[model samples]
Target: MDVAIIGHSLLGGPDPAPAAPRADAVHNRRKILDAAARIVADEGPEALTMNAVARASGVGVGTVYRRFGDVAQLFAALLDERERQFQTAFMAGPPPLGPGAPPGERLRAFLHAMVDRVVEQRELLLAGESASPVGHYDHDAHLARHTHVTMLVRLLRPSADAALTAHLLLAPTAAGLITHLTLGRGRSPQQLKDGLDTLLDGVLSG
Candidate 1:
């Protein structure tokens, strides 16, 4: 591992203290991902080509490729970042869970929190449709989904198929679905939130 990371430094001494990531490299990477996200949002996932991302980010094509390897890799990296953000928001963010509020309210707040994140990450998700054949990017998403469903199931009545019902409840409110319903068909966020409340009410009425 040391050899892989530091090459000759491993022979010299303990990998030479690991240089910090260059500021320009970090900035360019962020810029590329941001540009890719914006392009996806503006023109759809199909627009997220490496060349286009490089142009949009004002970085060279080589720079984009070096940062991301390819369009699929870039999308995967972006989704991975989104997954981390979502995890932090739902599990560790302000209020409810962070403040020791009631379980039910925490659950509701979690749902809303998930909704907000899904909405924000819609573009990355769309771009990720054709992401790497390996599917590592999806690992975090799958984990989050199961973790969320498990939490919801614990709060739900025993009669409900917790996992199935969780999926049903969340599917419509998922980023892809919500985007289609809202942007594609002109539905408002309030309308969707109301429907979400109704769904949750039915599920939790017990």
Candidate 2:
């Protein structure tokens, strides 16, 4: 048996190798992403030009492009990172659950905590509208909401078709809907909590 070891350069093709990022380049990329988030939250989605992100991050325009290709790529990356953070907080970070609470109570706490994040990050949440091409909803946030809904089902386990219950919960608990109700229409936090309680009661009353 002849085993040919493909060299690193030969493994892909003769195409231009992606240059390894320098320490400064890596730092610049982080800065650009952070700055983009800050600016988009403070201003609006329309404010997230590559030039503006570079200026805000103190990186050259070329650096921004090199790190993120273009505005769409940059926005996608930023939203992805934010989505991961939200997931981490709910699943692993110090929160209403703290990783050891009973499943039923954890489900309730997760709902409350999720609403709090939506309210606290209202502007950032709004900027996430571009998460979809139609600019109508944040796909990442939707995915997260589905994740939350699934967790609720796993925790609640009321024998009413867990998957369907997850879907029902997801529709109303999605980030966009929550934002529209709480931040946009001035729904009180307690009111939102009560709604969740009612939702859970209906689901688990069996």
Candidate 3:
């Protein structure tokens, strides 16, 4: 399965709401998001605008504004959906990633998976981090990942400062840094994962 599709399915399968959204509203929203995702994927987030989205989605500019407020909010919603999918994968989807593995192994798997996700969505994520540097730390997705990593770190080294250690471990995987390493330095995702494993070796072995 496509990673995004698998993640999306793991997050919730299909909507099970008893009261489904209005057909037209749902259609319009899907169109807008599809257009927006394509635009960001093709031209980068900086190229996104309500007018551009409206034209691409075949919706009126007023409709785009009514739905998303602005470019930032649209990107926020997009990121939120993607983040939820990622969280679901690591939180409840499978062994090593979700559960049923040793703390060290799961932590390794998590880091590798995160590297894949960041590389796949580098543009959107870089834009998000650029939009708010400190705010990234406060995002629900980041907090959740931090909490999971903290738990793993605590299991691996009970005496260590798990919270701080978690933050330290995650710092290297920050979107901007990943973007720089991949785009500027031409590092592959596997290389990033290998570096993460080297860091884990020191933390886990000591």
Candidate 4:
């Protein structure tokens, strides 16, 4: 048997390579992402720009491009953390909104929670949609939401067209639609929640 020894231990491989200098890259990346998030949250999505992020993160503008590419890519990464947190809440958080409650009740809570989520990230979501409207329906997060809703619809009524019903249920939650209903028409988030409640009644009752 031939043993190949590259660095140190016979099979243990070489001495640990120099600690990756990427720690600085990672730190800078976090700074940029956090800065982008704060800009969106504090000043609105319109405020997010490569230059603004560079200034806020104290990194050079070129570094922003190096770390996250262009504006569209930055927007996508910005949504990553938020989408993860929102999904965690309804996917595994607690009862009526999560796993422990009856399917009907859980679905209702999920829809309402979704309304609140849209309100929370309205500008960010709208901006992301504007940047990539065609891809929105095909987004992994969107598909995951659809899958979850379909499961609930099926659980509530085995004979229902669960797939179609899931799509319909999610229609009202689109950031653009929600924005139109609220900012364009002077409707409120509470009203959106009420509408979703009514919608759930019609869908699940039939």
In lDDT terms, which candidate is top? 3
| Model 2 stretches with alpha carbons more than 4 Å out | 1-22, 127-148
Off by over 4 Å in 4: 1-27, 42-46
Worst 10 residues of 4 by lDDT: 1-10
| Alpha carbon RMSD to native, model 3 | 5.4
Residue-by-residue lDDT tens digits, candidate 1, 10-81: 112232555888999889988998888788878877788999998999999998888789887887776666
- Which lDDT tens digits does candidate 2 get at residues 138-171? 3444544555566667656755576667767655
TM-score, candidate 1, is: 0.74
- Global lDDT of each candidate: 0.66, 0.67, 0.84, 0.81
- The TM-score measured for candidate 4 stands at 0.81
TM-score of 3: 0.85
Pairs that clash in candidate 4: none
Worst 10 residues of 3 by lDDT: 1-10
Question: How close is every model to the real structure, measured as TM-score?
Answer: 0.74, 0.75, 0.85, 0.81
How big is the positional error of residue 61 in model 3, measured in Å on the Cα after superposition?
3.2
Once fitted onto the true fold, the runs of candidate 1 whose alpha carbons sit more than 4 angstroms away are 1-20, 97-99, 127-138, 156-161
Please report, as a residue range, the 10-residue window in candidate 1 with the lowest summed lDDT.
Answer: 2-11
RMSD of each: 8.1, 8.6, 5.4, 10.3
Count of clashes, each model = 0, 0, 0, 0
Q: Tens-digit lDDT track for model 4 on 128-173?
A: 7787797777776676678778889998889989999999999999
- Deviation of model 4 at 53, angstroms: 0.3
